[model samples]
Target: MTDTYADLLACEDLLLFASAAISSTGQREFHSGAAEQRLSLEFLHEYVHGTHPDLYALALALHVNDHNAAAIVHRLLSNPRTGASAGERARENALIRRRLAEMPPQRVYRLFARLARERVNNRRTRATMRAWIAARPNLDLDAVKYRPGLRAAARHARVALPEEVGVFLFSPPGERRRHRYGSPLLRAHGRAHYSASDLYDLPYTVAEGFAARHRVPRGVFLEGVRERATRAERLRLAGTARRHGVGAGPDPAAAPLLRLCVYVLSLPTAERRDRRAELEGALAASALRAAGPAAGTWPRTAAVLDDSYSSIGSPVRRHHPLAAALACHHLIRALAPDSTSHWVSGHTDPLTVRPAGPTHLAERILDALDTGPARVVVVSDGHDSTPPLLADTLTLWRRYVDPDRATAMVHLNPVFDADGLGMRPLSPAVPTIGLRDPRTLPSLVELARFGEGRLGLSDLREHLRATADAYLEAP
Candidate 1:
């Protein structure tokens, strides 16, 4: 019984840390400032790593955001391995490799730069850094785009670079101007200083700097760089591109589901209404793609979505919580097809749903429960107000009305509640999971079972091991 109780505590701790890891990026939320968020996150990372180092490492294989993943890698690599078997260390190393590969190039470069700054040049760290940098498809492009970071990483890792690439990165400005580079991108970078035409051949981010240096007109530079911009870049610069009289940017349908939702919410209500057909069609298609095989799988689903004022999030992450809710709203509908969404403010239109009124989650929960959905998914920051009866309602519903536990329910919180040290739970009766992206909703719901106290620590470990194995095995 003592061992069981200990396992239960460990499970709870893991869940709590996972929630913070997935949702919090050490940025300010609606209620918490950046400092508080960072401090809380740091404490949780240390506590979890001390308590369960293996589970802490396994989180990299899960849906942890890039920020926390970098932190996890740093923490794991900074410390020497002890007590773990050879197989365990190998699994941890594999997890790190996969995660570093999965992170965006700029972020990984930044992580490498950070490791260099911290002087974390252990054998494992050096090998990991060297391997990742050596794996880059185009070191010339990296040198041009992320010169300082690439140089720092190479120096710290002691990894040798191609001669021209090394000169492009390490040579002084005068020396680079005197020398010629074989790589077109590297040559373009050197020429971009004096030649406006050469800037277009470089990546948009690198070209932007050269364009500014050359005093090129914004319109002309934008036109020239349009072809060089990535899909995500085009979407991000759509408004700017339009203001400068570029074409109607990229198609909305090309956006990933979560990014598209954020973009849709960023637009004014009138614009969203005007482009309702195009936007809705794109959202439906993206959500369907994100749902994949799970699309239209669950029947009679209901979602109690929070569009309360708190969903406005902080200035650093404007409408982030609401964006998560909006994305999940469409995803749940796609997943169940017949899923009903009940907004806390009683708003019906998902497109025009904005964060305004106080959170009234209890009433929405009651409305959703009345519909007898096979699954009740609540997407909120978990800040229920106007009497705060969400806990009681869920508790009583589970105890009296749903004693058989036929209806499944899970709370997905997009914002981390620093005060709670995890996602603020609607109730202990319902399992709450931190959600960063709507695409991971299905798997996250499945993962929430351990938090329900029914699954032991061994079961949780098995799940983590399986997840890590699959993650490593995937191409």
Candidate 2:
């Protein structure tokens, strides 16, 4: 092939891989099984790394899910030769550190454990693992909560631990029970196996096993742990807490937008209705927080949201697609107060939207376009019940109705099409970007310009480089 054709092909391939990274978390989707998802994702990662190693490294800065982020870190760390130059290697190392810091503690520990399992015990791996473990704000909490993972990582990386922590982790069970510990957290953990009261002092996740072993009453355990639970832990345990008659669950207002949307959808319809005021207020506030300075800026924007049955997602994800659409619904409302929303099922209330209808995307597209907005954002999995009709509709609208292209459209798909190894686009006329987190909505929309074929491969490389630099420089 000619040089231009090769560059175009490379650009398309990179975009496809990027979309997969953003949407696929190696989990089952509505139409694809978990194994298929994993296989496709692995293949894409390999292809992208082989073809465009620099862009693959830069993808760490994008809104990739935890699974892909871990995978990227593993690939880069395991294969030092992947970086062709000293500067490239430094950038990759910096990106790895940033991504690792952004991930949850459990995930970072798990990544370290995986590295140990794979026997990837290179000098760089050892240093990175040791540094991360040493930098943790509370190693005592990690020892209690993630004992096995922390122990394995420390051993693999040969990370020296605090004197008390070393004994707490490596001591035999008999010795641990007999020896007195300096750290209160460690002392509680050692006593938790025999003492129920001590379990309350430990993190809730670690305390639960001991609580069960002691056969502590669920209600009592919950009440005891309520004061100690973190915000995220409280949100997760709220339903159980309510069932057990613990204080009214954590306030919804403090939750992040995407998480709040998922939490709301996890509740039964009756509870959601009963808590309508609280939930709606939380959603609105979270959306404003997510939008930040960009809130209420796009007065002429419209959204075509999909609430079809396929959006029910898989058991693993549980209403993930619908949740994304719901989050986008709130975000769009916040970003453009006057924007029109056209749901596929014609559902007017965002709070009670359930996935239970055919994907009539063509009609919704038509409705959105009729609003005469400057931009139209379509959030869907692109599984239209009537094949080709949505594409045909957009084609006709773009060709005859809006020949001047006054209205711009982009599709943000949350479901990964495993068979296709990328997002299932509704129409070639519109750019389809993968949607993972609602907070990244504005940036992803701006990124749609690259997917529209308006920019060349050089522009994409430049964009990735600039994005990497900005991310590394950010606090």
Give the TM-scores of the predictions, in the order they appear: 0.98, 0.97
**Residue 96 in model 2: lDDT:** 88
Candidate 1 segments exceeding 4 Å error: 1-3
- Please list the residue runs of candidate 2 whose C-alpha ends up more than 4 Å from where it truly belongs after superposition: 1-3
Deviation of model 1 at 4, angstroms: 1.8
- Candidate 1 lDDT (Cα, 0 to 1): 0.89
Worst 10 residues of 1 by lDDT: 1-10
- Index of the highest-TM-score prediction: 1
lDDT of 1 by residue, 111-224 (tens): 889888989988999999998987898888888888888999999989999999888778888998778777888777778888888899999998998889989999989899
List the global CA lDDT of all models.
Answer: 0.89, 0.88
